[model samples]
Every structure is written in structure tokens, then in C-alpha cells.
Target: MSAPQYLVILGMLVNVSFALAAHGTARTGRNNARDNLVAVAALAACLWWGGFFG
Candidate 1:
């Protein structure tokens, strides 16, 4: 796959990971989930652009 395709997949995974982390936090009402959703999302939206700004 090309770089754009890779970015798309990475962005998708980042979104899913974010949602998973959010749901887990909501499930327990605390910041206990061990994940880096923000960093991953930043990489997709900023570094990769996820095919939207590239």
C-alpha cells in the first residue's frame, strides 16, 4: 500500500483506540485505562494528515 493508504489505516486505528479508551474510562469513571490515545491521534492528524491534508 501507499503512504496515503497507510495513513488512512493508522487514522482509523487511532480513532478506534480513542473510543476504546473512552469507553473503558466511562465504564469505571476514572483515568485508569493504560493507553496513549492523544499521542496516536496527534500523529495521524498532524504528522500523517490521514489523507485529508496530505
Candidate 2:
């Protein structure tokens, strides 16, 4: 696969990881979930743009 595809996949994983982490933390009443969600969103945005940015 090309670099763009790799980036997309990596970014996607990062996004998913953060999402899962946030979900887990939610049960503890922690407030970091929002931050993780934001980071995940940013990663996903990068992944989406990487496909056409190159």
C-alpha cells in the first residue's frame, strides 16, 4: 500500500484506541474522556485528508 493508505490506517487506529480508552475511563468518572475524543477526531480528520493531500 501507499504512504497515504498507511497513514489513514494508522490514524484510524489511533482514533479507535483513544475512543476505547475514553469509554473505559468514563466508568471511573474521570474527565479526560472529552480530550481523548477530541484527539481521536483530529486523527480521523488527518486520516481523511491524507488520502487526498498527497
Candidate 3:
């Protein structure tokens, strides 16, 4: 894969990691709006990056 593709893949991995972390926290009954927001932002960023650079 090219550099941009690698970056997009990395961004996707990061988004997934964030989602897993958020899920774990939620399972613990933690009110982590910030984490959820960050995960959403990461997903949006991944989408934008993929659209622009993929």
C-alpha cells in the first residue's frame, strides 16, 4: 500500500482502538462522554482522510 493508504489504515486502527476503549469503559459503567466524543472525532477524521487521500 502507498503512504496515504497506510495512513488511512492506521487511522482506522486508531478509531477501532478508541471504540474498544470506550466500550470497555462503558461496560464498567463509567460516564465517559469525552472518550465517546474522541472516538467519534477519530472516526470522522478517518472518513475525511480516506476520502481525501485514499
Candidate 4:
């Protein structure tokens, strides 16, 4: 309902999208640990920002 919440939600959406994209990429014979790590890092950043800054 507030700005922080909205941003958090958006961040979560982005992380989810990235995960889906990574999954697709992996299925297409492009699976890589580096890509997966990036996605996980994004999710971690989102959670950290939302939890601390909010």
C-alpha cells in the first residue's frame, strides 16, 4: 500500500521473472551456474532492501 511495499512487490516480480527466464534458458541447453547465481543475487538484494530499508 505504501511506496516501500510497492517497490518491494516490484522487486519480487523482477526476481521471479528472472528466475523464469533462467529456467527457460537452462532448458534450452544454456544452463549455467553463473546465470543462476545472478538471479539468486537479485532476489537476495530485493529481500534485503525491502526488509531493511522498508
Candidate 5:
């Protein structure tokens, strides 16, 4: 894949890892919205960069 595709892939990985971390932390009563927001933002960026508009 090209650079942009690779970046999107990386972003997906980031979102997944962050979500897992957030879930784990939630189980310990240490989770927060900010963590989930960051993942959402990354997913948005990835989708935008992936050309959802096109």
C-alpha cells in the first residue's frame, strides 16, 4: 500500500489499541471521555484521509 493507506492502517491500529486501553482502564474505574475522544478523532482523521468524501 501507499503512504496514505499505511497511515490509515496505523490510525486503525491506534484507535483499536486506545479503545482496548480505555476498556481495561474502565474496568479499574480509571477511564475518561478524553481517551475515547482521542480515538474517535483518530478514526475521523483516518476516514477523512481515506477519502470518504470521494
Candidate 6:
């Protein structure tokens, strides 16, 4: 209900969305090293920001 909780929720949503997108890409054979790197970066960002804000 507060800002930190909101940040945590938002981070979770972002991570889930990224995971789904990465999975879809892999299924379609369109996934590449760069895509994987980007996904990893996004996940790291989500964790860092979420922890910091929370």
C-alpha cells in the first residue's frame, strides 16, 4: 500500500514480463545472446532498484 510495496510489486511485474518475453522468444527461435544479456540486465535492475527502494 506504500511506496516501497509499490516498488516491490512493480519490480515483480517487470521481472515476470521479461521472463515471459524471453520464453516466447526462445520458443520462436528468435532468442540471441544479446537478447539474453538484455534480459539479465533487466532482471538485475529490477532486483537492485526494488531492494534499494524497498
The candidate that achieves the highest TM-score relative to the unseen native structure = 5
Q: List candidate 2 stretches off by more than 4 Å.
A: 24-54
- Candidate 4 clash pair list: none
The lDDT, on a scale of 0 to 1, for candidate 2 is 0.67
lDDT, model 3, position 18:
67
Q: Show where candidate 6 strays beyond 4 Å.
A: 24-54
lDDT of 6 by residue, 1-54 (tens): 578767766776676666666654555466454555576577668867777534
- Give the Å shift of residue 6 in candidate 6: 0.3
**Among these predicted structures, which one has the highest lDDT?**
5
Q: State TM-scores per candidate.
A: 0.44, 0.45, 0.44, 0.45, 0.45, 0.44
Against the true structure, candidate 1 has what lDDT? 0.61
How high a TM-score does candidate 5 get?
Answer: 0.45
Candidate 5 lDDT, tens digit per residue, 7-52? 7667767866776677646464776656776767777787778785
What digit string (tens of lDDT, one per residue) describes model 2 on residues 1-54? Answer: 688767766876776676666664545576465677677678668856776445
lDDT of 3 by residue, 1-54 (tens): 478767766776676666667654556476565675676677768766768644
Candidates 4 and 5 compared by lDDT, better number: 5
Looking at candidate 4, the ten consecutive residues that score lowest on lDDT are 24-33
TM-score of 6: 0.44
Candidates in descending lDDT order: 5, 2, 4, 3, 6, 1
lDDT of 4 at 45: 85
Supply the TM-score for candidate 1: 0.44
Error of 5 at 49 (Å): 0.4
Question: For residues 1-54, could you state the per-residue lDDT of candidate 1 as single tens digits?
Answer: 577767777776877666666754545465532445665566567755544545
Candidate 3 Cα misplacement greater than 4 A, ranges: 24-54
Pairs that collide, model 5: none
